[model samples]
Target chain A: MSPLAALSAAVRLEVVRLATVRSSAVLLALAAAAGAAGAAALCALAERADIGRSGLLEAVTGGSASGLSVVGIAAALAGALVAAGDARHGAERTALVLVPRRGALLTARTVVVAGWSAALAVASLLAAVAVVVLWPQQQLVAASPGPVVLAAPLLGYVGLVVLHGVAGLALTALLRSAVAAVSLVVAWPLVLEPLLGSVLPPSRWGAVLEGLLPAAAASRLVAAPPVAAGTPWLVGSAVAGGALLAAVSALVLLAAVRGARRDA
Target chain B: MIEALALSKRHGSRPALDDVSFTVPDGVLAALVGPAGAGKSTVLRLAVGLDRGSGAVLFDGEPYSRLPRPAHAVGVVLDPRALHPGRTARGHLRSLAAGAGVPRRRVDEVLEQAGVTGARRSRPQHFRRGAALRLAVAGALLGHPRTLLLDDPLTDLDDDSRAWLLDLLRVHADGGGSVLITASRAADVLAVADELVVLRRGRLAARGPASDLVAGLKAGVLVRASDPGLLAGAILRWGGDVEPCDDGALVVTGLDMAAVGEVARAEGVAVHELSRRTADLDAALLSLELPETELLPGANPGAVPGASAVPA
Candidate 1:
């Protein structure tokens, strides 16, 4: 097989790999379930707490105002499992020679992991709609998903899932251990970065901090009360976030190319 | 042909391999045999581009990386950890086959070839050590590569399985495909290889035709006398290479059994025991796998390596 063809095959093989590993399969299922459940809880809360909660459609599509965004956390986890699991298992020893150039192989893995996260995002979205719609309408005041629900929020959700998934893959490649990589993914964005965002002075720099922080930026895309709606800062944050994604991608490629060239 | 030229490796300060070079010609199954830590694995890793070292490993005069589809060029089975714990034998091979663009049916083909078809559905983590090793070899053969680079392939195999693997290797070699198998004790494949590369403490000790090296090079005779020290001296003085074996016997090389007996008779030494001794690879392995204190007296310690050890 040609190198590029071999790489395409590698991606297909990776998907099969992701599917067959019982733990990964279970993790994906749990991620979808958690996302669905979180969205349902938020939809129920939005019915009563109409002021901050927006409406039922918004609540189901976008997550609750407080705590973690379910899709962000779920997608990040799916990314970690897909990207880091193979490296943790030393599967590359057999895999590297099959594709030889690790650039193609790692690129394929990142793409496949992002694709899986995207699928999870779609599933979570469907699951939320299912929960909110299936619930007794007598209990919820604004249970109806208005016509405006899927368009703008769908774009944001897709973007958030993709970005978080990419970050998971890049971080895993940087660390090279699944447990360490997954811990870094969970701790940095969820715990440390958010803590920093809260503690930092409320200034233009704080806005920038909120914009550039991976967790904040990713969560901003899908949060209930959208931060600084349609402002230049959100645009700037998206650009900065994109730039960070680019930097992380460069690092992932660098780690794969340079690391593969050296000792395994 | 496969050639490793001027390969050298170091882990911090200690050398792993030094200026090691050898070739495995077409239709030949070459054995890389040495004691533990003799850099056999290092050579295999460097050859397959899994590890980077000072030199180049060429396949048919091309560096290993330039092959584009390396799996099709060289099938590699280096370690048991090479297989994923969660992946079934079939899943592992099927995925590898996909990457190499080989037919999906080739998975079963290789499974059958490697003798793991019966357990193909089971996760390798649940497999017996021998079965797991076979599953890995099945993955290696998935690409149907022209060369096979195996590291310690015989580690957990019974004699029959080992013989079965050798038969497969013999067929591969007969088809003009070379196999470079790395092992600490290589007696199983020793008689089958066309060439032998003997390494010691990360340096090339010897490399030649297997027949020449395994014959007079390794085979020797042992003699037990009233005084092994005196018998050893007599053999040494009478133009024989003698080493003091802790078995209270003298291991005599560089001379036949008759010559050893003639020397003992001339020296008026009382011969308590005299026998032709051929070193078993298992015995050599005992010397390696055990601690120094648990070893056969002078079996590995203060002992000359390679051909000086008789092989049966």
Candidate 2:
């Protein structure tokens, strides 16, 4: 068969394998819960403030962005778990045997991680919308967003979520252990990168370093002010974040594929 | 046919497998016997393209990586516990089936064939070792591969499970499939293996048909006769070696079991008990004359045209 056929089979295998994992389901549920809670809190705040259509729409957008931060963590963890699960169970031996071509197998895993993250992003968005509409706040419920206004932020959140997941998958594949990947994923963004930023003197280079950091780029995509929806700043942040995300993810993924070939 | 061509692997300067070549023709159940650290598992990993080495392994003339559908060409079981702890037996097999692009129904077929159908819904960590092994084999068989490469599959199996697995392999080989399994002990695979490939210290020690390699190993019979002295005398006169056992039995060699029976009848020596002794058969299969640490010096590591070996 052609190489594409083999890769297609491997992708189907990964999809089936991930579907049976109970932990992935739990993580997805957690993303939904986090999303709903974030949206509900923002909707309640908008209702109490007696905001108008644009303000309510901005509140909903901000809330979804807030929810995505936690969803990003969940997505990362899900990707790490999926990438390292077979190794943790010593099942990579059989996986390598069945799929022979390590490149195809690793690529299949990367595709599945991206697909799952997208799914988690959609679920989180749907849950957030449910809470916003079904919430008891009348004023917030009445402020439905224009299709483009809503689609822009939601699309941004989905792209960022996929980026987080693929990055996690590549890191875990390179490390070959979930624990090591998890430690780095948590520490690099929350502790190490922030600490580096703090140690740097306030300068132009410092600002560039901050912008280049993954957490900073990712946050820019979703950390827009409540009044900033559909504005140029939101669009600019999305463009920068999307570019960095693509570049960094490609580098990590290439490294992961190369590592898998040699390690096997 | 499975052709392992000049397979060599080096872990740094130390060789794990050195220029080892052998073949298991179609419809043969072959055993690769070696002591621990003899590179049996390494050979298997290299065979399936799971490890990079100097040489190539071909399943029906194509390398494992080049197979149109590798899983359907060669099924490998390198570890029985190579399973996710939380994945149910059915789920594991289904995943393999998906990887092999086989129908989902093949999963059930293999689970039933491996005799783990009742435990299909249960996770493998909760299974007994033999049952877990069966589950792994079931996963391998999902593609109905023409060749099977199993590593130390007979280790730690109970009598019934061992018998069942041997029967399963026999049936597979009987149906024109190639079966290759590694074992630390020759006795494990002796009865079922049509061919043998012996490795010692990362080198090929011997490779030939099981019976040819076992030639010149003496086969004897034990008999407890009412007239022990008479039977001994007759067997000795017949040029068969006879030895008196402490248990009042005669150990007769150089004669078949039937010959011993006929001699007893002719001499009017009433035989109380008679049985064939396979004490040497085990040793013969493993070529026990060589010391455990002894490497086969100047041994031909390449494929032999026919049945030829160094005193095996």
Candidate 3:
């Protein structure tokens, strides 16, 4: 078979691997549930304020939402499960036998994981939209932005989710342990990065240093215009976000290919 | 044909495999026999490109890494645990089938052939070691490759499964495919193997046709006579060595069964039993384990057709 055809077959195989595994389905359900709960809490807070819930729902759909944190976390875990789980189960050897060229297998896995993350992000957004449009207030339905207006932000949200998932995959492949990768993915963003950002003084140099952190740059990438203006520490521009995303995507593919080649 | 050219591997400061080279021609069933930790598994791993080593393995003429689709060229079963515990038997086969780009129906075919069709939906955690091995074998056959590289696959199998698997391997070789299996003993593969490669301490001990190697092993005779003392003296006078057993039977070396009978009759001894005792092939093979120089000189050049290859 031609190399391109071989790679294409490998991609299909990876799709089957993800689809047939029950853990992937469970992860998707958990991400959806977390997204719904977060969206609901934000809606309650918006309703309590005098301005009402539509603005919050608009922001939730527009990529500046906070409740989707769990979705990203779930996506990351899903990636780890695929990479580290295969190694633990001895499926890695079988996969290499099927596709001897490590690069082709890595490419196929990355493409499938990115596609899975995008589908998951889209599902979460749709669920949030359904909740808003069906609410008794009905203002969100009337005030919803046109597709043209929502396209970039929606794409941004999908990109963020994909990056998070790929990062988990890359780290797990490099470390060769699911537990180690999981701890770092969770602790680094929620605890370590925030603590580091706070330790730095409120100065230009400190902002630049803080902005170099992945989560910081990721947050700035999709922060709403008003939120970006108000938050002093969110120093990363859209360019920084793009750079971070590219770096993460490249890191995942490289780590997977290199690690696979080095080991079995 | 599969050719392993001077394969060598080192783990830290210890040598796991040292310059082991052999070939399994088409239509041959070959066994790589050695004691535990003699690098039988390492050779298979290197053959399939699961590990990098000092030498090269060629399937027909192409290395495993260069094969466009390796599964379609060589089937491998390095470890039974290679199957995912969570996936059902059929699910695992289906995954491999998808990767090999074979028809999904081929999964059912291999499952049936491997005799695990009844447990198709059962996960591996629920399977016995024998059942899981059958599943692994099924997965290996998914691509119907021309050559098979099986690493100690017979270890955990039951008698019935072992018989069935041996037959399957023999049939594959008979049908013009090649099979290379690894075992810690000769008896396991002697029934079907056309070629045998023996390893000792990660180095080549012997490599030749199975028949020639087995023929070169020492053979003795067992005798039980009413006049045991008379028979022993007569056998000793005839230049035969005798060792008495607890059961009053005498094990005579350097004499064929017919010769022992002739001596007993000439001495007017009553012979209750006279039987040929074949040398323990496994023990004889182990006895052949010596440094390459020492091994060759001690071997029987006449008994073994390829004396050089048999360390004889």
> What are the per-model DockQ values?
0.53, 0.49, 0.48
- How well is each residue in B83-180 modelled by candidate 1, as lDDT tens digits? 67777878888787877778888888888887888888888877766777778778788777899888888876877677877788888999999899
Worst 10 residues of 1 chain B by lDDT: B303-312
lDDT of 3 by residue, B1-312 (tens): 999999999887899999989999999999998888889999988887778788999999888878877788898887787766667788888888899888999999999999989999888876877888888889889988999988887886899889988999999999999999999888888888999898877888778888877777667799999989889998999999888888999989888988999998899988998898775667756655554555573443213335345331
**Native contacts present in candidate 3, fraction:** 0.58
Which model is ahead, 1 or 3, in terms of TM-score?
Answer: 3
User: Which digits, one per residue and each the tens of the lDDT, describe model 2 over residues B28-83?
Assistant: 99999877888898999888877889888889999888888888888788888877
- Reference-based lDDT, each prediction: 0.71, 0.76, 0.76
TM-score of 2: 0.82
Question: Candidate 1: which docking quality band?
Answer: medium
Off by over 4 Å in 3: A1-3, A50-68, A138-150, A198-202, A227-237, A246-250, A253-261, B221-238, B241-252, B255-277, B297-307, B310-312
Worst 10 residues of 2 chain A by lDDT: A59-68
TM-score for chain A, prediction 1? 0.78
How high is the lDDT of residue A86 in model 2? 70
Model 3 residue B157 lDDT? 82
